[model samples]
Target: MNVSLLLILLLVGAIVTYLAGDKLASKVALFFGLASLGCTIVLLNHYNLGENISFITRWITQPNVSFALKADGLSLAMVLLTTALTPIIIFSSFGNEYKNSKAFYALILFMSFAMTGTFLASDGLLYYIFWELALIPIYFIALIWGNGDAEDRKKAVVKFFIYTLAGSLFMLVAFVYLYLKAGSFLIEDLYKLNLSSSEQLWIFLAFFLAYAIKIPLIPFHTWQANVYQKAPTVGTMLLSGIMLKMGLYSVIRWQLPLAPLAAKEYLPVLIGIGIAGVIYGSIVALRQKDLKKLLAYSSLAHVGLISAGTYTLTLDGLRGSVLQMIAHGFVVVGLFFVAEIIFRRYETRTIAEMGGIRAQTPKFTSLFLLLVLASVALPTTFNFVGEFTVLYSLSQINVWFAVLGGTTIILGAYYMLKMFQYTMLGETNKRIFADVTANEGITLVLIVAVLFFFGLYPKPIIDLITPSLEEILTQINRIN
Candidate 1:
């Protein structure tokens, strides 16, 4: 079968999984996820470094739009990440018995389809459609399955939905404006259209609001902590691990190249906000009692640095941001999964409530320790490689920015260590707790292996993204 056909089949399988009932839903979802991974490997095998794979059939003639999908190195990388993680996420949720398991699995599979579409979409309208489509399942997943005060969860979901949709409306306006001026909604065409500085500024702001809300950069991020804390483990995993990347990815794909001059001129202000988010997020995390909430704030800090690195518009900065996105996805998902394990054992997410767990669950403690270290970006972890490159790139733009941004490492270490010391070290809490289950252990171990494997040898990911980053940089450089 053609590769594109396989992609369509994966979506079809998701629907079928939904109808298959509880016993078979997980099995079907797992099969589709593995098949998607298989397709990704096939794509990797056929991938050409210098060329993109395009599959398009005209959808509308008047607007000059087509049902277009294409994969470059960057898109392919994201696709692989999506495929690789979806199965793990699906499997990770097996421990929780949901009232509607079939619907739950269906939503997960559907989310995978939407995310894959987001990465492959070449048309601006199509990208936005998929972008919005991706949020629906997650919203439902969090709304129906989330923990915390029932009323609070509902409020968090609504706030998240409203905040994201509001930001995206601005992006839609930006897209429509580009379509009006450029006479097409194709991303490549938008890239080629030359706009006056005034037009660029307005367009840039519109796009910035959309992506910033998704990245949830400070002030705009008011909704994220509540949402993450209320969300189910699987919901949090999808949100942090992949959904957040959509915003960061757009910053590179749309904002930077579309308005190069605006990006260059506003880079400093952007970097300053990124620095503030880093400090603010870390400080906030330091005070968070709920482990999930702490990780949520920590995620904000990490992505802030990524946003700053992206604005630098240097080759290393771009490369680092992309790499960091991948690394953070894996690390954060793993961290949340570990949190889920603790919650399962102790029936609580409070850090103070968890004590002396290391004695009872040595294996769980060991894996948790490694994940915490990865979160803090210890050497030979993927986070270290990404942070080092991002900071190096930032230094070229401004030493102070680098200095401010580098505090993430210090702050990261402080929070992660504090959590670790409280949870795993010292006296054993006399309360009864189960050791890590086989399934939980396998999931975490797999994630940690990937983190270390990529950390020690980031050359492969860097090599994959470099050509595409260079292509994007070339376009930006042409403006000046």
Candidate 2:
């Protein structure tokens, strides 16, 4: 039940997949992804049997850090997310022929490793290490394998890299400050430090700068749209699906717990900024002619709501944030993949160029429509559960805030329906169209299954994360 085994599996999977050669890399990667996910399920079963799944060993004595991996309910949720999404992501790739296929598959596994490590690392320095480790793979995945002009792709990847790197530096500084104050980077140790109001404020701001840019909220979100549009669909999936959750997860795991006073003090301001992103992103999405770009802005709006939910600092908010993180991860990946499906057929991203695809490909249309409905938070979809809970949390804070944040429902519906109608409905395009292939259909089916299953029975995931959120809220309550 050792949690670090999960990391080992993924890291080893990366190397093994690389060595497996180009022709077999995709299959090897998919196998490892499934194996890694199996590990999580087994770990959960052991957890239920009351076996210890957490273990730590001192790794860097100078920094007082440990090669630690701790999986609580919350950490497991995130790890499960990484593991669950990896196979789908890889499976999505099976339909394409990526050059240097070994490297491409290997990077995907490496990313899974880093993100899983990020979720499980309890030592601040160790967590920071994993945090920065994630950027490298995605950076390459985008840079080498990206689309559009070479120079333009280079610019976008560099901007994405530099912007996120700059954010990580601030987070490192904050961790350093905390290490000085507490003399250790252990999550438990840092939590015990009694910093003054001023100290908390600066540390809060520094960490905020890091997570804000990663989450890319409001004014700080400038790097997101371009990177998303420029990168290949796999790159875009990693970016939108799971990478963004690192920031939102950090806000709950690190920012709120470590600096409760600051979180409490600035709740209003933070929620305001998050809501602003919701409005701004949704409005921008309304006008996007590019399908990928539309999904990009739509991701911005959905995450803005999730961010706002976290700042509410209520149990409902935290729970909803977690729920929505999973929901968004699943839905956004599906949406982006749908975009890829469209582009592969038409070789164009322009929405106006696509119409009435359903007549030719009813199966693809059904899957795409299900995801679009989920994106708009339709009832009986998993996203509906997350969005409703988030809006409920906001209403608890203030009716007006909920009112503002709730616009995503109307706006999300508008834009998603617009995109759906233009792409999946209306007059059939004159070009030849084929139904989803077996591999692509399997991937989409897996995704749609998750949405419907969770949409019906979200209790399992909710229960899994609740105790952890409760523990976090206990910490914030003690400080406030």
Candidate 3:
């Protein structure tokens, strides 16, 4: 019944899967992933029934730290997203064989465990620990099993690692300063602080430095494309699907709540930056020949819109951001898998090298088209719901913001369709482009089903996340 059980399941799963050997590793990893999903569902039921699911115990009394895990609707929703996607990402890698399958699969589970903990931890110090822990597995995943030349992959992975780790230290310093003032590292305790405007601004900027690089907003995003282009498809999926959400999620969970005034003071600039990223990402994506690089830039754009929505500090904005986060997570993963599918067949990610795939693999072409449409935020797809709400929120803040941000859909459609036309249409490729296997089809189907179903009826998610967003808003407005 405790929230920690979710973390335990993922961690235990990682250990057991690692020990299970290469032959059984993938299966065991999938089993644990599904089990974690089940556990999250059960926790959701318990939370709905008004039971105490959050767990807290003192871990380091000196610094006032605790091993605490909170399962509010917001955290639970994120945990659900992590658990649900972990298995899908794991399962999608079935077609490719790695040299050390056990280690590869184990790192996936371990990363999931760290990410789940990051979502659930209620104590600031504990949250930071989980946040940093999530970085290690992904670093190894991209460095060891990643694609491209050894020196190139090493440079890309190392640059990403150093870039993110350096940004995180600023966050750690902020936490240390906050702990000094508040004498506690618990979220509620930190929220109670009534710091000066300048103090709050400094704290806010420090956190922003970390989140910006992680979310890779604008200039901070220099490391993103290289890393995404070089990482293995599974590594790419984890980064785009779930890891980047950590930065967006932290904006809500940590930055704004901790420094509401700073968020308010810098709202326009922050939103402008996000909108800029949207336009930038879309335009960059349009020119990329490599499919993974295109998708990576495409992610930068989608998340930029999501970030702008979150910075708006309205319920609709927050709700839209959360919805988009979930929608984007599923859809992006599906899209990357589509890229991987083509790579598996063609042995290349170059868009020009691919063509007439539609004539060869009707089923894959159909699913890939659906994912492309979803990326463009087409109506009756899950992405549409989030995109609409986000735009609406921006319009409320300033019509200009909405106008600028709306370009994502238009620009998104242009690039996505062009990529599709070049990669999937035209004369048949001389190489044999096989139809999707059952595993691949199942993954795309599951992703599409969730997107479309939620697109039609988004109320459940809206309802689930509203109260939590409202509380965060309350904390935000308490001083303002």
Candidate 4:
């Protein structure tokens, strides 16, 4: 089957989940989510067999945009990430009840559909459309179902919406300008343009504005911690787990290749900003009182490193970024779900209020400790594999960059381990904290298994993504 089937499956799934009624919506969404994962595995098999799976059809004649979906190793790896994590995110919400559950579940599926399309779309205009489409579901999801003071949540979500939208407009302008010059909005056509240095600089900066906001790098990341705390746990999981990766992926797929010279010229500046974000996010995370907000800043630190590695424009940088993207997705989701589990038992997000959970729930404490370890990039975890490579890439650029970026590991362990001591150790809490339920256990176990399995033997993934990274690296160096 062609890649369009993947989008069709999720889009149709959204509609079906909504119509299935509130009582059945979660189950329906899960079914479709698993089906999408299975379909991706099948497609990956076909891709490995050297079969053509990308789909394209003309959609606009005047502006030369096409309804296109391209499935190469890079896009497919991301697509797989979206599909694989979606079901886990959905299932993790099983224990919690929501008002208008059907609409909530439907929106979750719809967001998945949009993100998948963003990863696969080949036409710049189409990719931009899919990219913007993703913002809609999360907006409503956070606004309606989110926690905290209604007014506060509204302000946070709206601010996030505006920041990302304004940044994205710059990117749309860049694409439109490229279309005018090349008479086409397909990625290949835009990449072929031999623009002057000035033109490439503007385009690169425009795209960087869009991506940096979405990735929520330093200064641009003001909206992140508040929104993550305000949104419901499910929404937070989707945002941290898969949505932000869209920005990092675009940096590799769209930004650099389209403006290779600009990317090269600004390499030091870009990497500097990224490393700054790493130091900044980690320091901020160490001071957070709210569990979700801490995780949010932690996310910022990790993505910052990923962005820095990508800006290095080396194959190792690209590959490490991609690997870290996937590893971070799984680990962040697990960590957020851990926060949710704690909130369910204690009915609070304050780390100060939580304590002595290890006395009551050994299973949960063990699992939570595992997630924390993974987040800190412990050896034999998938995060370690990715972080090591990213640091190596930075060292290749400049040893000092590696030295600064490595602060994430040191600061990460300190904050995370310290948070664990306060939240799970110390005097026994007066309130009861039950062990994880079967559903919760399943979700945590699945994520942990994937992290460890890949950590020890990352060759398969390394092999899968290497060739595509090589191509992007070639494009990056083409103008040099």
- What TM-score does each of the candidates earn? 0.98, 0.99, 0.99, 0.99
Models, CA RMSD each: 1.3, 0.8, 0.7, 0.7
lDDT of 4 by residue, 1-480 (tens): 788998999999999999999999999999999999999999999999999999999998887889989899999999999999999999999999999999999999999999999999999999999999999999999999999999999999999999999999999999999999999888888878889999999999999999999997888989999999999999999999999999999999999998989888988999999999989999999999999999999999999999999999888889999999999999999999999999998999999999999999999899989999999999999999989999999999999999999999999999999999999999999998888899999999999999999999999889889988898787777787
What lDDT score is found at residue 428 in candidate 3? 92
Off by over 4 Å in 2: none
305-332: candidate 2 lDDT, tens digit per residue: 9999999999999999899999999999
lDDT of 1 by residue, 275-388 (tens): 899999999999999999999999999999999999999999999999999999999999999899888878989999988988888988899999999989999999999999
Which pairs of residues clash in candidate 2, taking residues 3 or more apart in a chain or in different chains? none
Worst 10 residues of 4 by lDDT: 471-480
TM-score of candidate 2 versus the correct structure, residues matched by position: 0.99
Q: Candidate 2: lDDT of 291?
A: 88
* Candidate 1: stretches off by over 4 Å: 1-3, 49-52
Q: How far is candidate 1 from the true structure (C-alpha RMSD, Å)?
A: 1.3
Stronger candidate by lDDT (1 vs 4): 4
